[model samples]
Structures are given as structure tokens and as C-alpha cells.
Target chain A: MATQDKREDILRAAEKAPLLSPSAQRLLQITSAREHELMEIVAVVKCDAHLTVRVLKIVNSAAFGLLYPISSIDRAVSYLGERMVVGIALNDCAAHLFDKQLDGYESERGSLWRHDLQAAIASREVAQRARVEINPDLAFTAGLLHDLGKALISDYLRGTCAGLLAEIEQNQVADYLEGERHLIGIDHTEAGSALARNWKLAEVLQMAIAHHHNPGAAPPEHRPLVYAVHLGDIIAMMGGCGTGADTLRYPLDQGYGAFFDLGGEDLAAIMLDVQEEFAKIDTSLAETKEN
Target chain B: MSNIIIGIGDLGASKGQDDILKTFALGSCVAVILLDPKQRAAGMVHIALPEAKINPAKAQERPGYFADTGIPALLREMKKLGCQPNARGLMVKLAGGAKVMDPNDTFNIGKRNILAAKKALWAFGLGPVAEDVGGNFSRTVAISLATGDVILSSPGRPNWKL
Candidate 1:
């Protein structure tokens, strides 16, 4: 198939991809609202029994290391706070979106899920370490969904263009993202942004996902968030978290460090923290699965 | 048979004939494998950075995170496994210093890692007898202790001996 035809096919498929559950959509709406109150988030979460259970389980999980088990939505919200509560709810609702083998990207089943989770964790850490004014939860969400396009585009690429992408990567002709553009008339970044927009994700998040690989290209208003997610992606790869064929194929914006006033030590420290956080979550999730 | 996974900033050595030392998803990171067929011992280190001087504290905490310290440390560990370091007895192989990003990337970490690894190995009068380094792909490298066979695999590519 021609690159243009393949691109159009993939974008059309992404547009019709399964939407997030109604509860997850509501959580996103409440969390992204400008003047949301704690009660509003609590009410939204309480509307769904499964979401409520997942949130409570996460708050009481060993990962959080809470002293006492929290049994109620109100207590879970109060203890974990509104942003964290909503983040956990969203994570639970969207878990299935990434729980698959992405053969086009050479990612095993659940690898993309782990990668997104690590990126989410690292995004929050980067926000704190960079001392940026962006909301950490928003950064986490953007990080988690930045690669959503890969899930959409992978199957299409697997059909015929898989060999082309491999050749580009193997021969050092182009980075993976660029190779996508060269062979498919589009890249995951653009495809992901489209999906984010379709889901009614916040504009900032859409922009962050679109420009994560090149934060400098993001609109000035959203650059800080984009930078946060970009750095988080790099840190996650360095820590040997979930990775695929394109794991290290993206370039780091060299100017980002100076733009954020970050030094190597700060990055190194953030990586250590991300590792610790990922380990805790992994252990907790593993235990959850076993039970 | 058992397989040992070497994470970034980690080093592992195995003397069991059935043990396979492997590291996965190496990008701008180098995996140095040393095997002594005579002793049935193999060691691998996943080095993430070129030098440790920038972060001595980190190097001390995780010597395998930097090439400067990791290469020497892995060699010492191999020696401890009753393997001779001389070229005649030990087979050295290198993989996974791939510049997977754009060609114009400023950091050029993959090239720097290879340089650092080469320098470190040369200091010990050792060098890779076989190598599959530098490109735009992530790699998984594994070495069999029993056969001293090194296998390298990348996404969308066939596995080949290194």
C-alpha cells in the first residue's frame, strides 16, 4: 500500500477505536475542570462501583504503604488526595488499552502497559525535580498516553510496512519516529494527538502527546508539560523499564536541560526515585494479580 | 538451565554450564560480555553512560552504570569466577551502543559509550574479539557460558552470532 493510503487507514481506525469507559471519561472531565471541588471528583468516582473498588485497592495497596486500610471512597479521596485518586481511577479504567503485544514495535504483551506506567511515574518525578509549575498528575496522564498512537498504528504497520521500518532502523537511515513518517506518511506523535483529541482530552495533553519527541515544537504555553513528559520518557528508558523497538530511537532535545535549569545530577537523582517508585508499584500490582 | 537478566547499571557472572547471561533493550548503552570457555564462566555488564567522573557517587553505588568503572568491575568479577583475563583464554564481545535517534543528535551517547568501552578495555590489555555495535536499533544480547556463544537480536531482525 502507498504511504498516504496506509496513513489514512490508520488514522481512520484510530478515530473509531474504542472510547474510554464512561466513568473514565467523567473522571477526566472532573479532573481537568478549572474549578472542580473535591466533592465533585468524589461524586464522579462514587458513581461507578468497579472504579471505586480499584481506587480503594490502590490507596490501600502496599505501594502506598498506608498504615491502615481505607474502606470508603471518601477516605480514599481524603488520604490519597483528589488528583491521585482521579489518576488511579483513570489508570484502572484504561489499563486494557495497552495490555497487548505490539508486534510492529517488537513489544511483548503488557510491555506497552509497563512502559506507560513507568513514563507516568517518571513524569511526576521530573515535574518535582524540575520545579516546574505544571500539575504533576496532568504530566503523568500525558506521559501515560503519549504513545497511544503506537497501539493504533502498530497493527497497520505489521501488515506490510514492518520490513521497511526495520530496514530504516537497522541501517541507521532514520530514527523510528521519522521512519514512520517516511514510510507511513505520518508518525505516532501525530496519530496519538488525534486520538487524544477524539477522546476530548485536555488541549495541553493533546499538544504534549503530539510534541513529546520534540518539545521545542510544542506551543509555548504547553512546552513545560511537554518537556516534563519528554524527560520522563528518557529517564524511563535509562532505568531499563518497559521498552520496544523504538526504545532509544528518539532524540533528546539538547536545549531542554538548560531551558529547565536541570543538571545531570538532578536527572540521575530523578531516575533513582523513578526506579524506586516503579518497583513499589510493580510489586503491588504483582501481588494484586496473584490474588 | 537458568537465565540471568542484567538490568541497566547491573553486572552478572555465571559459572553454570546451563546459565545464560542476557541483557535487553540496550539503547545508547553498551553490553560487554566476557566468556572463558575453559572454565565454563561468563559475565556481562550493562553500562548506561560513558564515564563515571561526572557522578563518582553513582559510580560507587552502581559501578556497572558507567563504562569507566563497569568494564573493570566486570573483568574483576570474571577473574573471581576462575577465568583467565588473557585474550587466549577469555573471549570478549561487545554489543548495543546504538545511536537509535537522529543522526544529528547532539548527545551522541552511543558513540561516546563505544569510545569509553574501547578505552577501558584497552587499559586492561583487552578488546572485543567480535562486535555488533552502532546503528539505530535497540538490541538484546545473550551469552551462553557453556559454549561461549554470543547472540544478538533486534526488533524486526534475525538473531545472529556476535
Candidate 2:
């Protein structure tokens, strides 16, 4: 098939039938590129009580490590800047998009949420190491949203996931991209990139999500962040308590290690640090949920 | 019968025809190889976590578990094998920091493992002559003391040079 037709076919197959809410669509359309745009976005977010509550809670949470409590959107904006506000908004919208159902994957809500957070954190860390000029928040946001398509796929596939798990077991699928492509004709990376485009997200985020699963194949500029998220996902999955069918042992990419100038010693050290930090993050998240 | 398995949370050294270090299923786990060609001595450390600074108690007991602690421990083992830090034939090569789980956001233990090891090595004035890390893949690496050859074996792939 022609490349254009192929894109259409994949886009059509994405299952994004119910478009984003009218307010979200409006928030996405703001292209004034002015300071007032930030106010507009904040205003839209404030109108939704559920999203507002989540935003406030997250802004006040230790993740941001604010010195003083932030009770209002304007304060959060003043403290965190417009980019962080946008990120929180996007994060909130994305989380609300998925249902809590496991879709036979057996991953707990905490496990999934933790996985996303850790990967984003790890991606930002890698960006720092790589000295990539990309925004860490952008990388984090991309990392957080990278696996969203998997949730959609799981929801859509529902009971039929048994076959997917069987294939993973037989082939030892290293990443979800293979399974997504095998069963659904399109993988999560592509699905996520489409979602980003549909939401009118920034180009960097779109690039990161589309190529995160296979960073080596991404365009030159986005490769480092993409690679970071790719590795981050693996770390999160491994650290997670119960990975269920997602626990296939895939081989390490020879180029990926070299890309970061990491020799074996470096690789070993990074694992230790991430694991230790993950324990802390896991604990904090647990406490947050409990409260 | 003598594979000299490098058990979890452990380090091993071998020389001449008597050296073997083997580890299994390293995911978000790190395996480090320190070699001294002149003395024909080689050592391997397979450890989890980065350093004691994150958790001092764990660092004290599992010094071989963090890169900061573990690299020193591996160097000590290499020294026990008569390989000095400034020894002429000393070189380092590394492997095994495959992302075991979580495929999205970038909090990668494997990548972090690779990074911490590098920092520790720099502090010790050692550099990797070779390495492989950071992916959704697992790895098995072996270093031969006699020939100073490192062999990396991975799933769905044949054994080859490190």
C-alpha cells in the first residue's frame, strides 16, 4: 500500500472513536503563543472539578517538592511555570482517559501508575546524562504517555489477551510493540503518536512517543530521549511487583549501551541507583494512595 | 562441573585455566568485568542497586551490590588475584543492564546501573574498553582469564565478542 494510505489505515484502526472532551479540544487549539494562552489553559482546567482536584493534589504532592502548599491553579502556575502546568494538565487528561480495568493483564493500578512515573523520571535522568537539549518535562511527559496505547489496546482486546500472552511466552516478546503489531496491526508507539497529534501536543512529545519503543530507528535529535524511555520502561517492569504477561526476557540492544557511553561498570551502577530510588518512589506513592 | 557461577549478590575471580564467572538472567541487574592482562587475572561482579549512600546499611552488608561499593569490592577481588590498580595490563569491560520491566517513562535501573558504574570507574581512573547495556533485553557475559576474551551470550542470538 502507498505510504499515505498505510498511515490512514493505521490511523483508522486506532479506535479513538470518542474524541477528547470539548473543553480539552479547546485547550488544545490555543495557538496564540502568548502569555494569556497559559491563563486560558488554566481556566479550562479549573472548570473541571475532578481534574482540578487532581491537579491541586499533584501540585501539592512531594513529587514537585514545593516548600509551601499550593491551593490554587494560579499559584501552581506561578511556582511551576506554564510548561509544568501544561504537563500536569496533559497528565491529568491522559489518566482520566483510561479505565481501571486490567483487561486480563493482571497489572495492579499502582503497578501501572508507578511504571509510568518511573519511566518518565528515568527518561529525564537519561536526558541529563546524554546532555540532550530536549526539555526534561517534555521527555517525562512523553515517557508517561508512551504506554497509553497499551491500555487502550488492552481495553479493546479484553478477554482475547490470552492469545497475546501465549505469543509473548512462546517468543519471549521483549517489548509490547511486537505484540501490539502482531495482534492489532498497529503498535502502541504509533497509536500514542497519533494520540499526541490528535491532542495537538508539541512535536517533541509526539516524536518521543512515536519512537520510544525503538529509539535506534528514531530521527537523530529525538534518539537519546527515546532511548531513555525505552530503557526506563524495562527498569520499571522489572522492579514492579507483578508483571504478569509483560515479563518476557528480551535481549539488550548493543548500540543502546554504547549510545550513552555506558560500559558494563556504568550499566551496573545505574541499575543500583535506579532500583534504590524506585523503592523510595514506590513507598511515597503507596503512602499517597493510602491517604 | 565447575562453571564458577557468579551467584546473585556476589563477585568471582579466576586466572590461567582455573577462572570462570557466570551469571544468569541479569535484568536491571549489573555484571561487571575487571581484567588484568599482564597477570592473566580477571574478576566479575554481578550486583543489584547503585550505592550505600541511598541506603547505608544495605551498602555495608552488600558492598558488592552497588557500583560505588561493588566496583571497589570487585577491584579488591582483582587485587587479591595479584592484579594491582595501576597494573600495566589492567582494563575494564562491562555488560548486563537490560531494562527488565516498565517500557515507558525513563526511570531505568539498567541505564542507571550503567551510569553509576561509569562514575565509580572514573573515580577509580578505570575506563571501559568495551560494553553493552540499556534495552528490553537480558544478557549473559563471560570473561576468560587465559585469553582475556569476553564472550556475550543473549537470547535469540549466538555468542560473540563483547
Candidate 3:
């Protein structure tokens, strides 16, 4: 297909992308706010009894191994915390996109989700340890959705994986994003940004999806969050949880140092934490999927 | 054939001839494939870092996550499979350790990991018989115990035996 045609196809698909669940929409709206109360989050979960049940189920699942089962939705929210709540809601609402196979990238069915999960955890870790006052929960949300654009563009990228890698290696293109644009006239970031817009994600999240690979381009206020996701994404790839071919093709903006004052040791520690969190979350979520 | 997946920071050895030890998403990480041709036992360690000194506690918890500790951990696991990793009888093949983006690599971890794996192996009087390392892409590698075959695969690339 011509590049223009492929671009049109991806855009149309993004335009037709399914809307986020009402509960997820509300959750994002509440969490993305600069000053939202925990009760607000609890109220949102309570509105959807089924979501509350699922949340409690996940918290009580072997993933957490809590001593006693928590019967209250508020308790579940408090225990699993913000990231876990957001993750469960997103996974339940967007299973079609999250669960689809990325054949173009030669990635398995669950690889994209796993990669996002790791990035989210790493991003949260970065935010917690960042030099600035970036919101860790927001960082986790942005990280979780950073590579969502890949699902939208994966089909368009089928059979072009080797070519993309070669072009990237030869430096014929700047990076994977450029390779995507060169081939299809559209990149995963753009595709995902469009989806984020459709979902009415927060301005910070939309900016993150748009410029995760280039945090230097984000607005001054949101730049640190984008940097957090960028570092988180790299950390995930380094941890060997990439979605496939495009795993680590994007370059790191060393400029991130201005936002985060981390060293090799800090990152190594964060990776250890991410790995443990991922194993538990993935096992719990995988069990949920199986059940 | 049963595919035994060795995850990041974890290693497993199998004496079952039909078992294949496999690891995936090897970006900036290294996979050390060991085959004891004599005992028909094989193991692979997915090494994620060059040194355990970054976090000694983590290295102690998951030795397979760092090259310095991973090599010895993999050898110990292989030993449990009833195989001796002697210099003459063991075949070492290395794959992965690709630089994943960033020209000004702050960590330059891929290079460090490659060297660390080699140094660790050399400490045991072993060297790789075959290797396909240092690139700008992720890889999924598998080694069969039944045939001691090392198959390396990447997205959009033809699968080849190393």
C-alpha cells in the first residue's frame, strides 16, 4: 500500500476507535485533576459495582496475597492504590486493543500489555524518585498508555519489521518513529495521541503519548512527566519486556537528567522493583484472563 | 518439544533431551546459551546487566539478572542437571547485548554486559563457540537440549542457528 493510503487507514481506524468505558473515563478525569481527593476515586469505583468486584478480586488474588479479604470497594482502592485501579479499569475496558496480537511487530498476544505494565511501574518509580514534584500516579497512567499507539499501527507495520530495524541500524532514519512515518506516513505516537484525544485523556497524558520519545518537545509543565515515561519506557525495554521489533528503537533524551537526578544504581534498583511488581500483576491479571 | 522459558533474572536447566531453554525480548540484555554435549543437558541465563554491584541485594535475590552473577548462577543450575561444564565438553554460544537506542548511552550497558558475560565465562575457562551479539535490535533466542541447537530469531529476520 502507498504510504498515504496506509496513513489514511490508520487515521480512520483511530477515528473509529472504541471509546473508553464510562468508569475508566471518570477515573481518568478524577485522577488527572491536579487536586482530586481519594474519596472521589472511591466514588467513581463505587458507581460501577462490577468494577468494584473486579478490583477487589484482583487485590485478593494471589497477586497480592493479602492476609484477609477486603470486602469494601474503598478498602480495595486504598490497598491496590491508584495505578492498580487505573490498570484494572483500562484492561477491562480496552481489552480489544490491549489483548490484540501485534503481528506486524512479531510480538505475542500479551507482550504489549506486559511492556506497558512494566513501563507504568517504572514510570511511577521515576516519579517517586524524581528531582521535581511530578505526580507518580499520573506518570504511571502516561506510561501505561505510552505505546498504545503500536496497537493501532501494528497491522500497518506488518512485514516491515526487519526493514525498520535495518533502517534504524543504518541510521537511514532517525529512529523507529521516523521509520514508521517513512513507511506509513504515520507513527504510533500520533496514532496513540489520536486515540488519547478520543478517550478525552488528560492534557498531560495526551502530551505524553504524543512526545514520549521526545520529552524535550513537551510543554514545560508536563515535560517532567513525559521524561518520566520516557525513562520508564527505556527501563522496561532494558528489562526485556518489549513488544517486539520496535522494542528499543527510540533514542533516549539524555536531557532527562535535568528532570531526574538518578544514577545507574537508582535505575538498577527501580528495575528490580518493576520486575517484582510486574511478576505479581501479570500473574494476577493473567489468572483473571484465564478465569 | 517442551519450551522452557527462562525469564529475566531467572535460570533453569533441564536434563530432558526434548526440553528447549528459551528467552525473549533481549534488548540491551545478554543470553548465555550453554550446552553440555556429553550429558545432553542445556541451560541459558538471560543476563540484564554487567555487574551485580549495582545492587548486591538484588544480585543475591536474582543472580540471573546481572552478568557478573548470572554466569555462575547458570553454571550452578546446569550442574544440577547432572552435567559438568568443563572447558572441553561445554559449548558456549552468546546472543543478545544489543545497544537499544541513545548514541550517548549513559550506561552503555549493552557493551558492558557483553564483556561481563565473556569475562565471567573466561573465569571458568570457557569461551563461546558461536555468537551473534551487538546490534540495534531485540532478539528471541532458543536452544534445544535434544540437539543442542541454538536458534536465534528477531522480528522480520530469518531464523538461523548459531
Candidate 4:
């Protein structure tokens, strides 16, 4: 259980795990949206034929919260908007990459989907409050993808989730990072950072993903976005709107206080808004159950 | 061993007895605690919003979730229980006011709830002894009347005793 050994173990496991570079690369290329880059993403998805199918599946999936189903990829792109389409493409690529079910993480098939949606919504709302020049799209994308490493970890670890959960319960690990560090040899932050690097994601996003659990660990320049992801992760987990092993952990890093200028009442309002949104999602969950 | 459990959106407990005043999943909702050690009685309020002025009627229905109404109401209840405000050794502590919104994209509800609670306490000449407010995490907050210790639990976080 030594920290160094644990780190080594995690590095070994991560080394053997299938890299998400392909999906990450696809996302980076798709998100570019510049003249040549946009054409590249569009052409890649359009030409691949497989991605087109995956995009259609995601658009029509109940996970998208869409009222009506669409037929074609171009139509789906048009209906969802280019930005959303790009976001959806990234989501689909991630989903495809991690096709196998993740062990140790609790939640139904679409729990990850729900978590992504909630984080995106929460991120957009928080950015507005801070009056930061956040690309709602970027925030949403980051929020949705923040936990990508979780899926990778779960898939890679095989059956380690149950043991990890036991440790979390026994030690009262409020955050999964502790458990991940103890059991898996590497935490999601490092793995996520590696994946981000492999995918050629911007340095800021990679840093944000790595330091999301504790944005204060990152430098001041990257603090804003990482802080957003941290908040998004906390809100999503607390809402209980999503299912995952993380739902059990209630982490409160003291460093979180330094990130923002929030007082007690504003904190209350934020919780209220989060709860309000959760209520909406809860209704949806109920409807899904009723159906 | 018989502990009184405070349900969601509600707070009720007393000191010297095994009272557990709690608020579940407090997002932007404020859980305010007033403890009178001498009286050995404690009271809590789970305010849903920052101020009562937003909707007087709704405040009347859920007085526990508004700053203007809930704070006063909890104080009155504490006084009725013989825990006179400022008369007995009254110590106020506050928790819960989580930001469900993103730090970048959402309105600052956590900050708003804390501010409103502070203002209400200031108006009533009360101040908090300790506090843990404002974050993206949803908090399940409880107060132990036996020791007037406030306990908070959140996912992937440490518990705090304020």
C-alpha cells in the first residue's frame, strides 16, 4: 500500500489498457471547426460510415433526452446544431471506445450519460454566475467528458470496483480518488491527463481533467476551468441524479474554498439551483421508470 | 440510543437529549443551527431560498427554507423551548449552501445563500460560531444536540464538525 508501489501498479495497468487516443483524436479534430479542421472532422465522420452509424444511435438514444428521432447524420447535425453535433460526436466516440461495461462503477447503462448531461448543465450555469468568458460549449463538453477516465479505469480494472467500494465504505473515503490511489495504483487524474495528452487535447483541458478533484493543485492560470469541472463533479455526484461508485464519496477539499469568492447565501442559491435541475431530471427518471 | 431524525426540508432537535436535526441534499438550501448550551436545547432551519421577500405566501408554507422568515421562526421556536435568544448562551452555526451550478457557467446560489443567512443573523444580532458553506457538493448536514456538534457528509469529501 506504499504510495510509490501503488503509483507503479497503476502505471502498469494503465500501460496495458487500450488507449483512447483514437476517440480523443476524433474529438479534437471534430471540435476544431476551423476551415480545414472542420472539413476534416466532417469528412472523417462522413467518410468513416461507422461513426455516422454511432452518431445516429446517440441522437436517437433515450439518453439524448430528445423528443423525436432523426434519420440521417446530416439531419441530426442540423437539428442538434454543429456545436452540439460536435459534442455529441465526442460523446459517441467515447462511448464507442469504452464499449464494454465498467466494473466497480455503479449505475445503469446510461448513468454515465446522465452524469455527463448534469455536469454540462451545471457547468453552464456556474460559468454564467462567475461572469467568466467560458464557452458554454467548452464547459459543457468538459463537464461531460470530465469523467472519461472513470470509464476507462472501470473497464481496465476488470473486477476491482467492488474492492474499491469496500475500501471507500470502510475508510469513509469521501472522494474516489483516494480509493483509486490506494487500490488501482493510479488515480483517474493521472490516467485522464495521460489520455488527454495522447488525444492531443489542449493543455488546459488536460490540466483541468487532471486537477479537477482539486483545482487548487493546478496553477492559477488553469484554475478557472479546473474549478468549473470540480464544481460540476461535486454537484453531479450530490444530486444523486446519476449512478456510479462516486455517488458514495463526499469529498470536501479545503483548497476548494480558495477558488471562488462565494459566501454562504450564494452557496445556498447554487445548491437550490442544482436541486431544482435535479428535480427536473428526477421527474425524467420517474417517467422512465413508469414506462 | 433513541435519536430524533430531522427529515428533508425540516429541522427539529434539542440539546442534552439525543436530538439529530438534519437536512438532506442541501443545494442552495441553507441549514442554520442555533444552540443554547445552558438551556441544553438546539434548533435548526433548512431554508430553501435566500430571502423571504421573494414570495411571502410560499415562505409562509415553507418558512424553514427562507432567510427572512426561517431564521426568525427558528429563533422563536428556540425561545419557546426556553433557549432565549441572546438571553441564554446562544451560539449560532450555519451549513449547507452548495452551488449546483458550475463555477463558471451558473449563478452563484451558494454565495447568495451564505450572504442572506449572514444578513439575517446580523439583523438579529446573532453570529455563527462555525460554518461550512458554498461548493458544488450536495451536503447532508446534522447537528448533535448532546454536544451541539454540527456534522456534514458529502460524496468524495471529508466530514466536518462545526
Give one digit per residue, the lDDT tens place, for model 2 in A240-269.
Answer: 322234543333344465456654345444
lDDT tens per residue, model 4, B1-162: 356555434556465476577666565567888888878888888766667665567577667767777788778878788876563478888887665434352344556667888898888788898888875455677777777778887533457788
Q: How does candidate 2 score on lDDT?
A: 0.62
**Model 3 chain A lowest lDDT segment of ten:** A263-272
Best-matching candidate per DockQ: 3
Clash total of candidate 2: 42
Docking class of 1: acceptable
- Per-candidate local distance difference test: 0.77, 0.62, 0.86, 0.62
Distance from true position, residue A167, model 1, in Å? 5.9
Which of 1 and 4 is ahead in DockQ?
1
**Residue-level lDDT tens digits of model 3 in B1-162:** 798998887788888877888897787788998888888888889988788887799888889988889999888887777776454477899999887666675645777788999999999999998999987677889888777788998776789999
DockQ order, best first, reads: 3, 1, 2, 4
Best by TM-score: 3
Candidate 3's C-alpha runs over 4 A off are B53-57, B85-88
| DockQ class, candidate 3 | medium
The DockQ figures for the candidates are 0.32, 0.09, 0.65, 0.06
lDDT, model 4, position A134 = 51
What are the per-residue Cα lDDT tens digits for candidate 4 across A55-121? 5665565655678778866676555444454555565455543333445564446666666667766
**Model 3, span A1-291: residue lDDT tens:** 799999988888888999998999999998999998888889989999878888878888887888998998889899889878989999999988888899988888988898999999999999998888999999999999999999999998888888887887678998889998999999999999989988889999999999999899999999999999999998888777888878777888888889787875676678778888889998888776666
